[model samples]
Target chain A: MNIPTLSELTARGETPEILFWVGCAGSYDDRYKRVTRAFAKILIAAEIKFAVLGPEESCTGDPARRAGNEFLFQMQAMNNIQILNGYGVKKIVTACPHCFNTLKNEYPELGGHYEVIHHSEFLQQLINEGRIKLTDTTAYKGKKITYHDSCYLGRANGVYEAPRAVIEALDADLAEMKRSKTRGLCCGAGGAQMFKDAEKGNKEINIERTEEALNTGAQTIAVACPFCMTMMTDGVKAKEKEQQIKVKDLAELIAEAQGLA
Target chain B: MIQQILFLLTLLGFAIILRKRIVQISRTIRLGRDVKIDGPTSRRFRNMLLVAFGQKKMFSRFIPAFFHFLIYIGFLVINIEALEFIIDGLAGTHRIFAPYLGGFYTVLMNVFEFLAVAVLVACVVFLIRRNVLKLPRFWSAEMTAWPRLDANIILITEIVLMLAILKMNAADQILQHREPQHYPSTGKLMFSSILIPVLEGYSTSFLIFVERFAWWFHIIGILAFAVYITYSKHLHIFMAFPNTWFARLQPAGYISNMPVVTREVKSMLGLPIEEPGTNEPPGRFGAKDVNDLPWTSLMAAYACTECGRCTSECPANITGKKLSPRKIMMDTRDRLEEVGRNLQNGGNGLDDGKSLLDHYITREEINACTSCNACVEACPVLINPLEIILELRRYVVMEESGAPASWNAMFQNLETNFAPWKFSAADRFNWAKD
Candidate 1:
């Protein structure tokens, strides 16, 4: 749970336009952490007054909601609401669909409402708004990037193009997984599935989804959800082909191209 | 002739009354919460084509399935023949011997009678499986509301018609008209020749009376079944179409947004659901009774063929936890009727303005749901019990109050710690930490 204090929000006053929700996924892994940190820097350079929601932000209770435990969901919803209000926050941007879904959909069910945005959608808006420019074109070696859409973000929220637009902005080759967009396969992590042991099904859902990514001949896999990033990265390691392919969250990819070390 | 005509007219009028009652029952039951399923739509359509038309999802057992498929298809196709029989009989064509048939008609009647007997035999086994063995758990409970004498009536009716058809076939050939010496049907009922001569030497009035008796019984028995089929859970005959059409369009794990939160006002002790007024009342988070459900949820009850597919696939029922997905749908239908009757007069009949749990859903039954959505996946008609369970959980948590202590603590932990685990909220990203 990474949260911001009210004093910081109040100090910025009616002017801070962005609140970077460096989600559980972005904060957990080092490479992703560095990349998201760079994402913050890019937004700051783009003149977006963004503050990190650190430590006070908690899990989005998506697992509880999926597990049919509404008590737990309401608890998380009310808590997030209080914290967001304490910061006097009106807008939020996050990378994980799990968090995005909880904040966007589940919160209202608990009596709190806030304007929420996914990081890809935010980046697309920034680029469209001419916020940041890529320093170089065709810089990275071609690694046919394949994107895995998170279920909550794609099917649940209907946010499709912004992520694609970000990938296209890279001028890199893009291939699609067998299941993507609205029909995206569950990474076996939705509905508190991340908390419970995988039930009976041929092929772990996340691994099966990853194989679809690998089938695209993409050496690198990019993800929007922190759970997906972690799951796919773990999947890549399990096949012992870690030395050959790499997993990157969207922000890290943007940061790498920005020449950030 | 007067008694038979009066009996037929009386039965026809009775059928109209029964039809009206069943439709009213259907409307009342289909009035609860909205249920959404994520199952594939094309699969449901494809399956119905195979099952209802091809009789596909029926028992895998060979003999019964064969018999049932024949009976099912025979009843459907042979409907035309029954209409012809009724029209001819009503026109005063009560013949003492073969009247309409020119030899060929006799053989066709023989074949039709043979098929009808085969279907009836198959139906007897179905009755045994349901009543004697109690193989389908819901079937026995479902039987309570149906006419108790149905099984006996169906059996007696089929046997009598079969014998009468056999008698008429052979009698027409010997006493009335003779031709087609090498016919296939004549050999099967060849024994009827012994009885035909005894009748042949009799007066014409006696023969005409016997023929009228057989005609009346066959026509009346089948039409009664048609009306009965619409009145009961066996109403699946008519309801299966719209029921299946409403089934979840994807897989079971798919969830459509829920419609309401239901709570028994008597049992509910927590958040007061602001009555629907100037403010948008906080949406109902769970279901407390049949009335709490959307109209579509009630429609799901009617659509259920009482196939018990949901119960058979339910992991909860397998472990003896006492939650039958089949029973949930059946119970909803039953409760709807019971409750609807109570409310039909515009008063809370069973509740007395009290909580419905004392009579409706048991606590243990409520807890047994895994929310696995298996029942939804297995159901061809697409009733989502998971949504109902979750909505019930919401009512319990927010209003009726008290839940499993483990869930309670986890709910608290969910507030401060991002995970249900007691870990600090800041650690939500810990899994991603290398």
Candidate 2:
């Protein structure tokens, strides 16, 4: 269960191949913390040399920027970039699409440049590299699992296939919602909505999106973003179908299938 | 000779009006801040070809797209015959290309006839869809009186124009039969020939009058439409090409970084700035009006055809939130026009005590956006309403610090604790302890 931080690795004059950016949501959201642990477990099982920023890692300012507070966003971005640069980190992987998008696309201009990959793509890479192996008969074999495309991961960046590929590797039935991929519905937590009440609407966007997932007849709704995990889970509960359908992160599913959980 | 003089004068009048409109629209769009959209000319060209010329995105909805394709192709192909009309009017000749093109002229005329019929049918179907069937998109809150009437007027105008082409051809066919020397046989055009039976009973002189009247009507109608489009949402006909060409090629999710804010942040942090600082006073932190937006954004405002596809696909609008992306574009265009007229009347531009933010688009609407880029993705012409929303939101938060109270707390937490929540950074990896 031991996890190494970048500082610990650096104190020993060592560097991990990749830095696991446990985003604010991944770090604190109780439900999403399990996803963080699950992804960490998969990395350990695959023997990938990675370390978390832990106490040093700060929010990537995705929320602040999205909330239209550029000053706070840049301030946080600059501090994080300085820390990442000081650690000489060259590559990053995270379970949060928000962090993945900001660190990958938005940071280079702010002087933080690194090869950033979402955990979905990273998991697909691991499975492709034969680093992570699933048992022949896994927990989700032939089970209906629908992956909700996080707006950040799917339309924002174009990483639609990797998460589905990871789901396919579970030997599960991938039921796509009517609106998915490039046309994917937002889980309603984007644009800093997660931190605030939704402006009054007929229904919560997550409920609307979850209805699509439910209509797909998928027993399990899979997600890559922590925000989607929270929203979809709340949606399933709101629909009173939590007992019938479960929402799990891609990493959690992979970790379970690999018996690393 | 008298007819030729009248035709030239009419043409000159319409051309002057169209030119004036084009110049005014160009100036209004230039009122926006200049953004350097450079390099990668090849990609931009491909985008314009596929989105504008190819009508690729229209196919997303099969039925409407099929009918729209009819009108789009019909309009472009029929313009070829208008070229002939212009040449004939200039030289005082009837069917001038008939001798040179010979049988091919008949074939070309037949194709134009067929397209005219198609355009007529499509316009009728569009009219029915708008008024009869009442598609929700065409009747959104922003689609008040003028927009709804404007749509119907364009469709009805197209129908009239298409009919004129058929009537002109049908009368010309009869004239050719009676007076071969003056009328010269161009052969029977398919769709228009159906009208020959009805017109066969008319007197020869009356038939000539009908042909002349129809010709003038068709030509004048097209000229009027060309000028009318600059004032209508139909501006998409010409603006789509330029708008799609200059579309933000970056991924839909990439909100452009403000270099001005970046430099200021670097200075505040005591970090060495890379680019030299400007001595000129920093402009407003974000867009408060159309003048504060990038020129591409303003062009997008003019380019939007108010199809409501963006609004229909919008998550906020779908859930009955007041945020309609289509309304955002329409409001922007309206505000820009107001500003343009204000400036023209010698009033201060963007300082007429009316701004695009609260005056046109309300804070409630812009704040309702999920910033999911659904509107951006749904746009067939690549208009990013999300970009406009973000810009306005930036203005609200940066310039006025007018964010909702809860958001202010989130910002404070992000500033102090490095996360939206007040949780300490030390506990970041507490889950690992398990």
The reply for model 2, stretches above 4 Å from the true place, is none
Worst 10 residues of 2 chain A by lDDT: A132-141
Model 2 scores what on Cα lDDT? 0.91
Clashes of each: 38, 0
Q: How far in Å is the alpha carbon of A157 misplaced in model 1?
A: 17
- List the global CA lDDT of all models: 0.61, 0.91
Which model scores highest in DockQ?
2
Q: State which docking tier applies to candidate 2.
A: high
lDDT of 1 by residue, B1-434 (tens): 67658656856786787777676676586566444444577877776676555655454436556766777665675565666665555554433123445465556555576576676677677667766876755353433544335544554555565566555554544534332332223333444555676677756556555655665666676666667655455666666666665554532433333323212221133544544333446554566766666666677676666666666655455444566666666666767777666666777754765433435566556565544454664554456665555555555655665555655665666656565666666564453233
Residue B79, candidate 2: how far off, in angstroms? 0.7
Clashes of 1: 38
Clash pairs (backbone) in predicted model 2? none
| Cα lDDT, model 1, residue B422 | 67
Show where candidate 1 strays beyond 4 Å. Answer: A1-63, A66-261, B1-8, B33-56, B59-67, B94-111, B128-207, B258-283, B343-358, B432-434
Model 2: per-residue Cα lDDT over B1-434, one tens digit each:
99899999999999999998888889999998879797599999999999988988888888988999999999899999899899999889998999889899999999888888999999999999999999999998899999999999999999999999999999999999999999978887898889999999999999999999999999999999999899899999889999999998877777788888889889988999999777988888778999889999999999999999889888888888999999999999999899888878898977889999999999999889888988888888889998888889999999999998899999988877888999987787788886
What fraction of the true interface does each of the listed models get right, in terms of native contacts kept?
A: 0.14, 0.79
